[model samples]
Target: MTETTKQPIRVALVDDYDVVLTGLAHMFDRYRDRIVICEIDANAELSDQVDIVLYDSFAQPESDRQELAALVRNPRASRVVVYTWNFQPELVESARTQGTHGYLSKTLPARELVAALEAVHAGERVVSEPPSKRVGSAPGLDWPGRHEGFTERESEILALITQGKSNAEVAALTYLSVNTIKSYIREIYRRIGAASRTQAVLWGVAHGFSPDHHRIDHWLGGP
Candidate 1:
């Protein structure tokens, strides 16, 4: 929702890569009225007042966790969206479980990233549905041809994980309990043998399945 010259949402970007930060800055520049983007490439001091935190996994692992913990501690966070370059399902899952706002790919299109920010700000979980498979583990695991084993709902969850959507978001979108979504996703991993998000996305791509927002809307049944 764009307003004509409205005040921007205060935002912070924490990442180790300058290129990623710059790209994000440029993206937000267009939404300058919607996102202020106060801090770029920050290592710490994730404020409570900001609308959201666009953080990198490598830049501040512990610190990022601490920031998340703090946000939940108050139970009144503005919002926190992670823009991760190195994908890991466990880490992303952990962040989702920990109450971070959303997760997205660092390499995702600026439009997608912006959409994620707006979604998170609106308090919606925004993740891209990648694909579904038998599920596998290890960063090195090669994808199999049969991802058809995962259920329609389970596949929907996997797609979100691949796109960096939080479990909470899955719950809302699917109208399932947070714990239920978590359980399904864990099962997807076990079935696919994937230990992380990057591997999952790669596997989804290798397999015939590809995540699309429409897939979730069309298949991940909800009210």
Candidate 2:
């Protein structure tokens, strides 16, 4: 008797920014044989039935469980995983209590990310090792302000600011110190020629820093 081959895991990427989701989708390009990207959703419903829903926590508030809970309740997704850079204990615990299957770090390499997803699909709850603050982002990821000389971290801070997150709020969401958030804000202001938060918000609004509302199905043609 011959053994049957396993089918590729169907995955849907979810986020509020198209660029963020697009960058994440590209990370799985080399492993198409094992993973199939069904759709990239931005502020939309999960349209396809998928084995996993990889939610990217780009500029979103980590403390809020409303969106995460919605994903967990969706019947179209068999497993929900959070792809985030913030690994604060409370956030991880909240996700777990809300029925999130995996809490993966954004610092995970592409290969490890795929493997973790495999583990989740195999009925195992997975959480990545807590990464050190010095660890850099995984290679080959993109964000809204890369071309404008913003590092991924800086870009994330700017995006949150654009969404009206105060310094304190940003610190709370990213698990960074308030002074550290201010330092990033200063750099963001310098890069964009903005003197005040309002100016920076305007610049961000003009430069794709706001949340998007659409779905990207072109990568694999259609969901």
Candidate 3:
């Protein structure tokens, strides 16, 4: 329970196995006053009784992930937390794009879970730190910032494409319309003399896109 005296935050707990769910439920029962675990159900629809959801790994089939994404898209679906032992960088990256509020490994301590939940409810992403650096932080993609190559916007959009983000997702991240992203992508292709995303990516790799590389144009100076 939160000693801070805020209204109790509703949470839903889900696990297919009764033992796991009961143990977690009992643990959360101690904090019911501040972080109420409203319902403990196995394989049940979780839309009611909670503002946030803590899902287990058994809930990770493709259909289930889509369901979770839908939950995150709800008007009240503000916080979607996945508490699973099976954490993958690829899955975490994908889930982040889907708007999950947090992704925690199940083996974390009780206090860590509470802190994660608190952060999520506080309108923050709850990915564990030191955070994995798979997505952003690609310095080469800051094209505009570099007199060396692309405009900042172009570098970013191109980086996501190379990392395999869909145009729709790239649009969401950049706050650009999907067609706008397409236009930027086309512009990138034209600048690179590449006709398609694949060729552009290959051109990027040939030039430079990471810590270990730098583009040829920076040295060759626009042939």
Give me the candidate number with maximum lDDT. 2
The 0-to-1 C-alpha lDDT of every candidate, in the order given, reads 0.55, 0.91, 0.59
Which digits, one per residue and each the tens of the lDDT, describe model 1 over residues 1-223? 9876655566666553343344456665555656666655433344335677666443234234666666555432467676554344666676788877787765565556667788787779865443234322212111222245764446556655555667787665455689998788678778889898678777766653442111011111110
lDDT of 3 by residue, 108-205 (tens): 55666777788888888887644332322221112221444675457667766765678997776565699999999888887878887789777665
Off by over 4 Å in 3: 1-4, 47-49, 62-64, 129-223
Please give, for residues 26-80, the per-residue lDDT of candidate 2 as tens digits: 9999998899899999999988899999999889866679999999999999999
Poorest 10 consecutive residues by lDDT, candidate 3: 214-223
Clashes of 3: 7
TM-score between candidate 1 and the true structure: 0.47
Q: After superposition, which runs of candidate 2 have C-alpha atoms over 4 Å from their true positions? A: none
lDDT-better candidate, 1 vs 3: 3
Ranking, lDDT, top scorer first: 2, 3, 1
RMSD of each: 14.6, 1.4, 17.7
Better of 2 and 3 by TM-score: 2
Number of the predicted model whose TM-score against the real structure is largest: 2
114 Cα displacement, candidate 1 (Å): 1.1
TM-score of each: 0.47, 0.95, 0.51
